[model samples]
Target: MATEELNAIEIEIARNRLSSIAEEVGSALIRTAYSPNIKDRRDCSAGLYAPDGTLISQAEHIPLHLGLMPTMIANAIAEYGAENIREGDVLMTNNPYIGGSHLPDVCVISPLFYDGELIALVATMAHHVDVGGIAPGSMATHATEIFQEGIRIPTMRLFAAGQIQSEVLALLMMNIRTAEKTRGDLIAQVSANRLGLRRIHELVDDWGVDGFHRACDSLLSYSERRTRAAITKLPDGTGTFTDYLEHNGLYAAEIPITATVTVAGDQVTVDLSETADQVDGAVNCSYAVARSCAAYVLKVLADPTLPSNAGLTRPIEVITRPGSLVHAEFPAPVAHGNTQTSQRVVDTIFGAFNEFTEHLVPAASSGSMSIVTIGGIDPKNGTYYSYVETYGGGQGANPDGPGASATHTHMSNTKNTPCEVIEREYPLRVERYEIVRNSGGSGLYRGGEGLRRSLTLTRGKATVVAGTSRVATRPWGLNGGGDGGPARVEARTNGEVRELESMGSLQVGVDGTVTIQTAGGGGYGEPEAGR
Candidate 1:
């Protein structure tokens, strides 16, 4: 009769049913997206939230996107005014200043209603290959302002009265270089949200809208309680760690990322104001990403098992100087800011958490997750084109097993494109993809192995961008474990090697070997700690 009146078995069954819906949402989005990042790599997230923006359930999508949705939703509602949102209207935006990471990561949201009453918001987010920026792809390292970053869509209707708005679609087409592919992806997102919404409404029919809402609240509150309990188990004190970047895009500036964490029983205060100032380049992070990175540190170190909701975030607070590298100002090119800085920020948080619980947090991960943004004419169709892809490195080792080979670190939940897909989509061939033997750090539990991939061009021209770490500093292991291998990229232009960035694009005529080697993760504990 009532939510609390249900027995434990009843509650468990309800939870599973809700989980099934989350899975359905994920499947629909994955099936609908156009890019490898979503269709195969699965670089997206789907979740069910209470009307008040608390997590009810989520499909096991990405760790990063899943973690940020609740906060992002709250901010979105505030921007659009929840009361003004209509039943058949959908809202979309990629404003980093509001709550997104970058323009490429566009989010679409819609309200679910039954009997003319609000039930929940069905939301889906995907990373489009291009979002109409200065560069063909939105990830431009040379551009120093947000204007060059890409399309910045404010919270407005992409769909209205259940019909696709032609004006909104036309505006997108007018700005982006690759209008067709971008428009296709946009339609796919709208479709995914509608599918998710239909499923949510079905859920309401089974559970009643009010009952569903109440259950969401209870689950999120429960998650908060569980996380607090875990925090209380740890010692109350302060911990800190610092990491560095190779350099800013403009000048030779080795940016420093410092995280100071105060663990007072169950609550954490993460202060990043002491870090280096903002750059004249595109290495600045928005506050949403900065907060998400802070939350990521907690997930890796404190209690990953704690349900991912606003409740788990209740124990943590992230403080950054408004205009620092970690917290960039508006119009500052931030396309690459969050990914580059957040990786080090996660490492810094790990460094701090290591002091509070040495057994839980291991050494650093393969520090670099590079991107290769290619641009040129599509050889097959002679169309101007751009593609942004991810490269995998080795992962840090843990107590039970070694890290996986060739993986994306931190917030990334994307997969490497299948060789077949790469061949079909672009004018490049992945000459080789293999694990680099002995790349893992040496320990009882060795660090994961790094990878090496060779890209050969068949097109008239292409750009190969590299953003790698461990080229200067290797992945540091914990306790007495050995460090992982270094990161290096060699470009043989008629057989001449050159240096690379963990985050820059390159242009090649044809038949170029862009060799990328990723760093491995750090090991955990002393070699004999497990023994």
Candidate 2:
């Protein structure tokens, strides 16, 4: 039967099944992964795509990684001609210039076949702890160029014809600092794709191949219809808002990210042309990252219940200046771009969207990922170490109630490194982990509060590099609400305590303590009656 012949019930079933398959792939990778970053924090995403690289369904994962897979798949197919890719061949890449958010995020792509015909692509993007850069964690805060951030892997086959490429594995292992962990995570990704392929075959067996494809197409069209309907309800006008990054890693000057949202009939355009130019730091992001951020805001503001696919991005257009902070050129460092700038982009978009309709959008969120990278040697085990993580912050308040506290939001959805896992795996001790009272903004429905976590090194000395935002400016509240508290970081070494800048590098001696307090979310409505 033709794709248009698929009924609504049949299309919904098929669409949900495809999403389940993507969820299964993510579950398998998280269960068998080696690093805490993947297994504990779950910094990964899985999705299924059409042969032409149109997104079909994606597991509920990191927003930054979700929207970039289609582009990456197209790049992979371009590098290795479509005719060269086989059923069992798997391609991998982490080059930001080639549809990637950053260097540490390695993407794996596997093509699926049914009855000797190419049907779909199973892909996943996972954040590895290390990818062999100047810094131990591969997230150098002061890096001036992309090369200094980490090794850049171009589109290439890691597995061919159902067999692992030994030389390719060796080269990858040789470059990264954590060879064993990286290898295990890569294997986990491969396993996840294979599992997805097996599940797809089962799905095809249940519903004929043609029926399955038709259902996918129907689902895409349905989502597009729902999104357009939602868009038509908004007023036809322009809403503009600007957000600032605390500073790029190389300087103390504030960086601006502006968004102008135009709603005309049933379409919206997010223009970022007036934003700051690319800086000489590690916070510059690719156009892909900018698109992901804008797409996320539109998806949330629109019908979020609609299945996420290419359809959600159909009515939205994201335009960025070629050499702006949100669309950096080649050789620019982007280690912190995926984590830092992406959050600001989300805030800027939402700020603009709120002007169009006050009740539709929530208050500003924490507006930063609060990335901390530590690397050193363990004196007892003599093992080189690199630890990368981001702390959780508060969520923005809605019209109905207060926001949630100590959680991930927007472009970043990574879980915090559990104290037990950190103490067991690394030479560090979690001295204190608790919520900071009154950090949330004061309003009728107050925003969520941030958290405080202190860590002490127990082994050899280590170098710590951190990139954070919301220090110079607080998270903005909506309507008559109050702004949220800003984030802060400090280090206490050898009885001398000093506050650290938003982005900087420092040395932590054995027994030195580092404390970080994440930012709170913005409030909504007027202040409450008392306190």
Candidate 3:
């Protein structure tokens, strides 16, 4: 066989093997994780990267973490250089400033070695149940500083020389409310990494490492070429768009996130510098998180066929001003930036792109629909439980297809823990869980609808928490499409509703009935026009 043929074959083998490695890691995480967050809801991510900290491939994971992997790996190498790393060492961190989105999404880094030399890294990050913060579940929308978000673990070794770092593990276990579960997930992350390392070795044995290395590089180069071609197809011009966050939950001020999108010679630059400054709430975001959001949006709206490596990000440059809403400062709260601001950024970009390529972008989605966690025990068993569920609204209608109903459109790939799983795990009973039909806007492509779920406590008392939006400014439609409705929660004592608008953290208790009413998405083109 020709040398070129061998090289090409080897690279293809490596690329395929890398995807296989991700799948293995994801399976191990799902099977081992104890929390519904990881097991059922799948609020987790796993990926493989080259030795130089370039993301090669990711398992079927969320968009937020897929693009953010390079930053996470880059920080891991920055904190602990290659020389300091040992064979069994696994690093972990959740610092947003230091290449992370939020504290809840913890990144576990493991170095992979072939022929006794570091060739790659395997990583897995999950939304931990708790990480010791001002809030019980670390949703800390009230947080004014990074300290209030959750535990900040700089890049540190979870395992040193094949042995668990007991000191670090013990300190982490002692913090969160779900200590036992966190410990298991922590070790499970390493186990998943180990599994990937083993699979890579198997691939190396089948074919020489030379081919595998070539394949990784080829995959990236191919992706870059494809992404550049996609850029060339966009209309060459500059367009600006703006969108607003209802409030910082203060009923005080409405901040606007703006994007000036310039497409020049097959390149796009999204500048968010004109956006508003950081406000008094936890709505601020780190530069890495902001870029990650931009990257995610482009990947979704532009081309999912691209490799999603540095190559794909080459044609796109995201600019944000420091201390602005996009670039948050120290001691400034930013937990909601990952969830709330991410959607706003996407919408802003969509709004900009809508002018250039109207048919490409859809209407705005029901933004910021995160899970509300409320759980604890009275006198029954003293075994406190933490329960959280994601509530979603309608997705905006598109020119071709109507939006999905009662579903999380973007930034929400998680699933609601099943009724059987909820009952088996905690002292709770799901009374009502169904779609809120006809809530969609009337249009050519009817907008997606929202959902309504009711849960009743079978036990004594359980605390429930929530962080959702689209209740204030409904989803906006494109062309003449209609808007998505509002979103709110309801708590009842003896079947009588109590609070209508509340962000329940650990302050509220649920004894009997609790119902949550979510919103729907907006329509796209005018129904009459399309007709």
> How close is every model to the real structure, measured as TM-score?
0.94, 0.98, 0.94
Per-residue lDDT of 229-325 in model 3, one digit per residue for the tens? Answer: 8878777877799888875643435789999888887788989999999887777777777677777777766686666666677778989898898
lDDT comparing candidate 2 with the true structure = 0.87
Give model 3 RMSD, 1 decimal.
2.6
State how far residue 434 of model 2 sits from its true place (Å). 1.1
- By lDDT rank, best first, the candidates go 2, 3, 1
Worst 10-residue stretch by lDDT in candidate 1? 1-10
Q: What is the lDDT of residue 452 in candidate 2?
A: 85
lDDT of 1: 0.75
> Which pairs of residues collide in candidate 1?
146-331, 396-521, 463-506, 466-502, 467-502, 467-503, 468-502
TM-score of 1: 0.94
Better of 1 and 2 by TM-score: 2
The residue-by-residue lDDT of candidate 1 on 1-531, one tens digit each, is: 235534445546666777777778778878877776678777777777766566677777766577667767778778888888788998888887776777888888878888988778877777787887666677777778888878788888988778889988898888887777778777787777778788877777887866776566666567677787888877788887888877575544678888888888778899998888878777777777778888877776666676666777878888989888887778777777655666777888788777766567766788755666777677778786766776777788876677777888787767888988877787778888898888888787888888887777776876665566667778888877789988777776666778675556667877766878777777655676553
User: Whose lDDT is higher: candidate 1's or candidate 3's?
Assistant: 3
**Whole-model lDDT per candidate:** 0.75, 0.87, 0.76
lDDT of 2 by residue, 1-531 (tens): 454656777767878899999999999999999999999999999999888778999999999999777777777778778788887899899988766888999999999988888888899999999998888888888999998988888888999989999999999888887888999999999999999999988988987888778877888888888888888977778999988887888878878899999999889999999999999999999888888888888878876786789888899899999888998889999998987899999999988988778587888888888888787888888877777888888788878889889888888888888899999888888999998788888787888888888888998999888777787789888878888899998999998999988888889988898888888999998886884
> Where is model 3 more than 4 Å wrong at Cα?
1-14, 249-252, 493-496, 502-506, 510-512, 529-531
Q: How close to the true structure is residue 39 of candidate 1, measured as C-alpha lDDT?
A: 86
